[model samples]
Target: MEEESWQSITVMEDKNGEPHVLQQKVKVYTSGVSEESPGYTKPLMKHRIVPVKDIVNL
Candidate 1:
């Protein structure tokens, strides 16, 4: 198989074990920045390459 033609799907599961389609998102991280930087803040959440869409309101 050619790397360019390879594809895959990822399904996220909720706390109830329900599956959901993952969504694409861009996130900006402030890790390793100096504390004096305007964007500096504690790393609250870990970043993932693919993030799941919010389904709480569904």
Candidate 2:
């Protein structure tokens, strides 16, 4: 099971006409079928994505 968290990708258009994507904090969940592992019920680390709107405050 691959848990993909959707996040807002900010972009800054430069004069060179290149879209530079900001490297924001994102939750990378490396999870798979529990049955396959047969031991770990949850992921090794619990990470949550930080929303762009809320990221400004915190």
Candidate 3:
């Protein structure tokens, strides 16, 4: 399972339109059932900062 969080910040406006910066946080959960043994593992988390336009274009 995965979870996500987002925050937006107004960085600047270009001739086209207003641009925004985004702060994104992601959490990934996995079952710790490996060859070694079945165990409990902490969730993995990641953070990223990107431009809104870049995502929109993609």
Candidate 4:
């Protein structure tokens, strides 16, 4: 199973050259158990950005 969350904010252009207050959804996942420790698990966090507006140059 995995836990998830979301947030929104205004910022500058991204690597894709898109500028504006973008709406995005953030997600976080739980990783597998660690090899060094038994019964212990490590959390792995990953982020993906999706552009809701057109790309522009600064």
State the lDDT of candidate 2 residue by residue for 1-58, as single tens digits.
4443434445555566654444433444444555355332222333343434444543
lDDT score, candidate 4, position 35: 35
Estimate, for each residue in 5-42, the C-alpha lDDT of model 1 and write its tens digit.
11123577767776665543323334345534443223
Question: Which tens-of-lDDT digit does each residue in 1-58 have in candidate 4?
Answer: 3445544445667776865454445554445454333332233344345454533443
* Runs off by more than 4 Å, candidate 2: 1-8, 34-58
Q: Could you tell me which 10 consecutive residues in candidate 4 have the lowest summed lDDT?
A: 35-44
- Tell me the alpha-carbon RMSD of every candidate: 13.4, 10.6, 8.3, 10.7
Q: For residues 1-58, could you state the per-residue lDDT of candidate 3 as single tens digits?
A: 3334454433655566756564535343445454455433333354455656676874
Pairs of residues at least 3 apart in sequence or in different chains that clash in candidate 2: 1-32, 1-33
Query: What's the TM-score of each model vs. the native?
Result: 0.26, 0.26, 0.29, 0.26
